[model samples]
Target: MGKNRLQLENHLFILPDYLNHPFISGNKLRKLKYNVLEAKKQKKETLLTFGGAYSNHIAAVAYAGKEYGFKTVGVIRGEELADSISQNPTLTFAQNCGMEFKFVSREQYRNKNNPLFLNQLKEAFHNIYVLPEGGTNALAVKGCEEILEEADAKFDYICCPVGTGGTISGLINSSFKHQKIIGFPALKGDFLNKEITKFAAKTNWELNLDYHFGGYAKVTDALIAFINTFKLQYNIPLDPIYTGKMMFGICDMIQKGYFDENAKILAVHTGGLQGIAGMNTVLKQQNKPLIV
Candidate 1:
């Protein structure tokens, strides 16, 4: 089958078909494929994972669990929910997908690898499979390998937003000999480069971490306006948490003459469209218009 078309300013090209699956879409779907298969190999009946209130990983795990007939448990990193309470949109979506939720204190949650924690969870739910936050595991890396294979042509530069660094790491690992991979981090922190280096060291490719803009989950008015303008011009949706920052960084670098005109850049649009819901609150709090 041919690649899907996405019209962008000054050019039109085929975009990867990441929306074919209802629950399994975008980068999350790409990362979860092998994780699910590995779970099956281990004969695990339940899939347990960790994430914040609006984590895409949590939503994907919930959807995958229900789709594959496995029980799912989400260990939330925050305060406990009261009975008969209304949930946030993300949590509501997960509940509708038949995933169980468990709230835990931030301190206790940090001990995710402690035997006592695993044992307690095992006793509560037998035959469980534990997936790391954002599904950043070796199995997820294997699944991400499929992304590089899906690219229609070789590119000089491959760009993607870095969150936990799993997706970008996978892209770097799967890069062709001549391709250079760069990760635009969405979070601000000194440790991101270190993390990327650690992951990249395991692979044959190196990662460039200079395009984070600000930091992870950190959005400025300029970034928001840029995202709005791009949507108006391209009519393609981008979540501020990742893809938006990636596009912003790419455009900035291009204008600054970082890329040669002959260089072909491939930007991975890792979908997290559900994150749009949170933008309403941010805009209202900032007294900004909802529309571009």
Candidate 2:
């Protein structure tokens, strides 16, 4: 992506979060930095994680685990995905990275954190380093806090897409009082406030809940069009699950006079471009325009 690609206005700067390694890019790398170390310290050889089908977290964790010499097991949410794993790009990538799958029904997945469910897993797989869904834990939050550097202090607004709240909570903690952290949630709900508040220690942040388009993993023609145009103009790839929605929300807010005219906003591109191929697969199945 060119430096001037995201020049929607003089006030906004887009940080291309996917320019790093093909795997472990953006906030995923930030969230995993500490967890991997702790797993090492604990002498864990197996990493067991949870995610829905086509989860970016799943792909990242699988790759990270492979690179770090750990046996990776993903407890996937949909049992139906078990037979179709070969067709799903995200799951296929994780599988190719040496991640084994334990697909359970949606009902069983609802109890993913239940003690009984965990005890059952303990019996099934010993020495497992468990990571929760979306990899949002205290260690993950601590890792996320390092995303902003000293040079980022000049920006008036720090923007990022909200997934499991760990990333935005980190942004909120690291941001200065004068620099408000703005999160555009990819899911439609006020429920994330409680999750974010669990780790956020500052008040210089708020959520724009109107930009989910539909809901988690949902997309509209307008959103698809916007994403396509954005890539064409910016030469940046954004996944539909997170960063795409945030960028749309930021642009819509700016257009609606939601921010101060002089406010300088830096949008953190929390990388999920890996999920785009899977997302486009879904779009094609639905007869929708593919994300260009």
Candidate 3:
């Protein structure tokens, strides 16, 4: 599993996790590993989850559910996206993987966990195995706990992109006492402070909120330039949503002496590469340089 990996500037990096499998590569694979098994354990035949137009979670759940022989339902966040699924790359990919959709307005989507909303889904898809959006549940965190290994204990810091807090929380739980887990969140706000810790068991972790780059899916010219330059230098394509921002934060922190000069760092590339195509389309419309 240590494939497409490299070391740079005293830091070790690995491929987009989405590359591990044609379908479930990246963090999605790790997040779903135990959930898939639990679903099978219950003999569940349908997987229900939620996400937006370009959610890696949606695509991953679709592919994993299809491959593992479970029916997939993606309750997409934006109701407007339903009519234009063919134009949306992520949704198109999930649809191709046989994922059914239930488009909900942003307001309704926000209430995804409301007992009433969940009851509606339960009624629609009986005995379905429900996965929280971003696929971060206890079992998913269990899967992420395995992302680190015995050999990884040597690093002084373990960095990862945080979306729904599951991945970083898993790292927090499995991290060694000497290794601090630094999460570069893709979204603004301290909301994640509570969400991530709920599943974490360690105190050796922190969230660098300065690198969100104007909130989720929001990017600037400077960010695009960094992404382009990084890809050219490292020969690694990073999605703008998660890994790109995390890498930018790490480099900024490194330059600012945030880490010890000899600190060894490991960054998990969670694999939101699929969203690049969609992001590029938007960039082109905005007359911006594309992520190369």
If ranked by TM-score, best first, what sequence of candidates would result? Answer: 2, 3, 1
Q: Which runs of model 1 end up more than 4 angstroms from their true locations?
A: 5-17, 80-87, 150-153, 197-214
Instruction: Return the lDDT, model 2, position 71.
Output: 93
Select the stronger candidate by lDDT from 1 and 3: 3
User: Each model's C-alpha lDDT?
Assistant: 0.74, 0.88, 0.88
Compared to the true structure, candidate 3 yields what TM-score? 0.96
Q: Each model's number of backbone clashes?
A: 6, 0, 4
Runs in model 2 lying further than 4 Å from the true structure: 1-8
lDDT of 1 by residue, 61-124 (tens): 8999989989999988876642321546677788888889888889988988788998898899
List, residue by residue over 134-241, the lDDT tens digit for candidate 3: 999899999999888787767788899999999999989998888899999899899999998799988899999899988999998889899899989988888899
The best candidate in terms of lDDT? 2
Error of 3 at 135 (Å): 0.5
Error of 3 at 256 (Å): 1.3
Q: Which of the two, 1 or 2, has more lDDT?
A: 2
